[model samples]
Target: MLCGKGLVAGYLGAPVLHEVSIDVRRGEVFCLLGANGAGKSTTAKCLAGALGLRGGRVTIDDVDVTAAGAHERVRRGVSLVPEARHLFGRSTVRDNIMLGGWTKSRSHRPASFERVLEMFPQLKRLLKSRARDLSGGEQQMVAIGRALMADPRYLILDEPSLGLAPIYVDAILRQAAELARQRVGILLIEQNVGKALSIGHRAAVVETGRVVLSGTAEEVAANPLVVDSYLGGAA
Candidate 1:
């Protein structure tokens, strides 16, 4: 559903990603695994149109979006849940989620909000509560729920489990897997190899801004190099 071809991008003047490429097929969870600063987030930003690419191209369902702005990408069904769960601290949970559907018409928002509430029942219960009062895990749910509010066909998630407890992390990963089963293509950027591998349909390992490995989850999980590099030789 989404494809990045030979993407080269960076900040300031120095390049962090070089010729990195990956694809997320329809109904699949494609996880991008790497150490800190391996350019996973940069790749996500490029795909979401949050960062402009210095080279290569990004496409969604065959439409080139390399130069499209973030909001334009959203209108084309690309939604990103960034690394930091950027929720409005002063806004109520409902209000925060509502902002995600700002791209949709007013008549369409109620149905979208209902869908989000169904996907995240916890958020439904805290609709009137302030975002700042929620726990980290709850806030993460809000972030995901907020993205779902946009009704995206392809969801780009960067570090969804970054700071949560094990239970919440597991919950979020399972929810991500469920989303894949529902045919929502996901580009999941994660530093947590084990959890990402466990839930991902396929995995790509990025090293120094390049995709060094790519394959099905089982194939990657059992790879000796992947085991040595990221899985601690457990595979």
Candidate 2:
């Protein structure tokens, strides 16, 4: 399990997360649902070690990693794909994806490359293409493929489907589900509530940096508050 217990963090001395906590179990998709500015990104940063924690601790497989840095977390098989799809415009898709294997031995990269391609075959022909030239959906795939190069045990994806067409959104979500099936714990932060819940094994709704609701996906989907609020009366 990848667990963040009582996470307390903020920016510039101002708090954003008020002791928020979450757990990601291997082979399952744990969804975090919330409106903008509800601390979802902040939480992902904390889990990914991109930000510091003012309080609480993060653990993986029962080992304390609260003090570890981002690089160390990545070395420990935790990879994060932020929403921005930060690819090097001048770099080829292959180069950008290969960069993710920085922590691994050079001999391990080829195998990892093949593995990533399995999840994103569309990237094969685009290997020589510059990241700046790909469509939004393709760039997103590269970003995710880059993260996969690390062979992460826990993958944190922040708003992966944002701004994507329906086809791309479905592809990304399906890939996430496939990763979960491969026993990689997934912490998915998404805005498409209905679609997210469809693949999520467990989920939580955050509001103002706090978890307002949490349970099995079915339970959360069935909750009256979620139906009225997040599901928009569609559930």
Candidate 3:
């Protein structure tokens, strides 16, 4: 499990999150749903050790890894696929995927690459193609394949469905569910509540930097706030 307890953080000394806490369990998708600048990405950054905490702590299992740097956190089994796919546009897909295995020994990298390719066979044909030339969905798969190369126990994806075609969106979320079944805890940050809840076993709504609502998918789907705010209905 990856957890944050009363996390407080911000940019340039200004607090963006206030006493936020969250839980993500393996074999399940813990979806964080909210609008833009609702601190969803900030929470992901804090949990993934991409940001400094002003207060509170983050943990992997029961061990406090609050002070660890991003690379250290990756080695410890936490990986984040930030929004915008963040691929090396000019780089070949193979090179980009290879970079994700930096934590592994040279002797074991081939196996790791194979494992990721198995999950994304489409990438196999594009291994030598530049990322900038691929479609948005293909790039998204490359980003995820890269994360898998890291052998992460917990995967935090930020708005993966954004700007994707319906088919690609379903494919990405389907893979998310598949990953959870394989025992990877997924922290999916999504602005599209409907799709997020569809695969999410549990979820939370982040409003103005606080976890105002959290429960199983069924419970969250029934929450009046969720329906009113995210389901395209009147409050």
Candidate 4:
């Protein structure tokens, strides 16, 4: 449902992504695996319209969104949950989630908020709580719930497992898998190689700003380069 072809993007004059390309199919979990500075986030930024393409194309369900800005892309059913989990620290959890649907009419916000709560029952109990007081796991849930309030067709998750305990990471990965089963196209950027591969339908191994390898989960798991580089020979 999403594709980036020969994408080149970066901050200022230094290019971080060099001709990277990948595709995410509907109802599938597509994993982008790479070390820090491998341009995984850069590729995601370009695909989600958070960064402009210096020389390439980004298409959503075959529609050219290469020139579209972030808000326009979100309107077209693309939403991003960045690595930083940028929640409003001073705001209530409910308010933070509601802000995600700001692009929608007032009539639709309540329903969207309820939908997010359904996906994350814990948030329902903490609606009035300040975002800064939540645990890492809860904060991550708020971040994801906020994006879901936008009602996106394709969800881009960047390192959702970052800085979390093993159980929390497992829970988040499981939730991500469930989202895929619900027909949401997920472009997952995960540092937890084993867990990501176990849930992902397909996986791409990136190195030096390029997609060095890509295939079905099993195929990628068997690749020596992938196992050595990312999986620590556990394949």
Candidate 5:
């Protein structure tokens, strides 16, 4: 299990997150849903160690990693695919995928690349294609592939479905489910209430940096407060 208990963080000493807590179990899809600026990304940053927490505890498989930096955390099997999908615009798909293994030993790259190819065969032919030329969906796949190359135990995805067409959106969500089934704990942040409800095993709704609602997917979807606030929103 990966967890954050009473996490608090922000920039310039101004807090954006206030005592937020979450739990992600291996092989389970634990989702965080909220509107823009709800501190969803902030929480991810704190958990993934992209930023430091003012006060909290972050543990992976019962090991305390609250003191670990981002690179150290990555080495410890945590990976983050931020919302931007920050691929090298001019690099080939293969080069981009290889970059994610920078934290690992050179000797491990080949096996990691093979594993990624197995999961996302679509990248096989696009290895030489420049990242910028690929469609949005393809770029997202490359980003995910790059993360997989690291063989992370915990994957944190921020707004993956944003700006994607329905087909691509469906594909990304399905892949997330597949990763969870492979025993990777997934902390998915999204604005798409309907989609998260459909695939999430457990869910939380963050309001003003706090978890205002959390429960099994069915329970959250049926909450009047959740429906009134987040229903009918597009990814």
Candidate 6:
């Protein structure tokens, strides 16, 4: 399991996450739902080691990793697909995906590349294409493929479907579900509350930098707070 206990983090001394705690068990999709400025992305960064925690304990399988740097954490089987699917516009899709294998041995890359292609066959055809030329959905696929190159045990996806077509959104969320089936713990932060809960085994709602509600996806979907606020009162 990937767990963050009593997390406290922020930018420039202003705390954005206040004692926020979460757990992502292997083979399950753990959704984090919240409005803009609710600190969902901040929590992802902290868990993925891209941002430092002011106070907290991050553990994977009961091993402490709170002080580890981003690279170190990646080496320890953690990966992040940041919001907006940050891809190298000028770089080839192949190069962009290969970048994630920096932590692995050179010989391991070919097999990893093949595995990613198997997960996203369309990318195989776009390997030589520059990232900037792909549609929004394709760019997002590359972002996820890049992260998969690391063979992460825990993957954090932040707003992965934010600006995609509905079909692409379904594709992205389906991939998340597939990853969970492969026993990869998934920490998913998304704005599409209903769709997210549909695939999530468990979920939490964050408000004003704190976790306001959490439970089985069904229970969360049934909560009046979630229904009225995020699901338009019909969840």
**Best by the lDDT measure:** 2
- Candidate 6 residue-wise lDDT, 1-235, digit = tens: 9999999999986799999999999999999999999999999999888899999889988889999988988988889999977899999999999998998899999999999999889888899999999988999999999999999999999999988999999989999999999999999998899999999999999998999999999999999999999999974
Residue range with the least summed lDDT across 10 consecutive positions in model 6: 226-235
Clashing pairs in 3: none
In candidate 6, the residue pairs with backbone N, CA or C atoms under 3 Å apart (3 or more residues apart, or in different chains) clash, namely none
Which whole-number lDDT from 0 to 100 does residue 22 have in model 3? 97
Off by over 4 Å in 5: 233-235
Model 3, span 1-235: residue lDDT tens: 8999999999976799999999898779999988788999999999999999999999998889999999999999999999967899999999999999999999989999998888888889999999999999999999998988889999999988889899999889999999999999999987778888988999998888999999999899888989988987642
How well is each residue in 101-125 modelled by candidate 2, as lDDT tens digits?
9989999999999998989999999
Q: Tens digit of lDDT per residue, candidate 4, span 50-109?
A: 999888899999999998999999998889999898999999998888889977999998
TM-score of each: 0.97, 0.98, 0.97, 0.97, 0.95, 0.98
What lDDT would candidate 1 get against the real structure? Answer: 0.90
- What is the C-alpha local distance difference test score of each model? 0.90, 0.94, 0.91, 0.90, 0.90, 0.93
Candidate 3 structure lDDT: 0.91
Q: Given candidate 6, what's the lDDT at residue 149?
A: 94
Residue 199, candidate 1: Cα error in Å is: 1.7
Model 2 weakest 10-residue run by lDDT:
226-235
What residue pairs are clashing in model 1? none
lDDT of 2 at 216: 98
Consecutive 10-residue window with the lowest summed lDDT within model 5: 226-235
- Give candidate 4's whole-model lDDT: 0.90
Stretches off by above 4 angstroms in model 1 are none
lDDT of 5 by residue, 134-195 (tens): 98988999999998888999999998888888888888899999999999988888777788
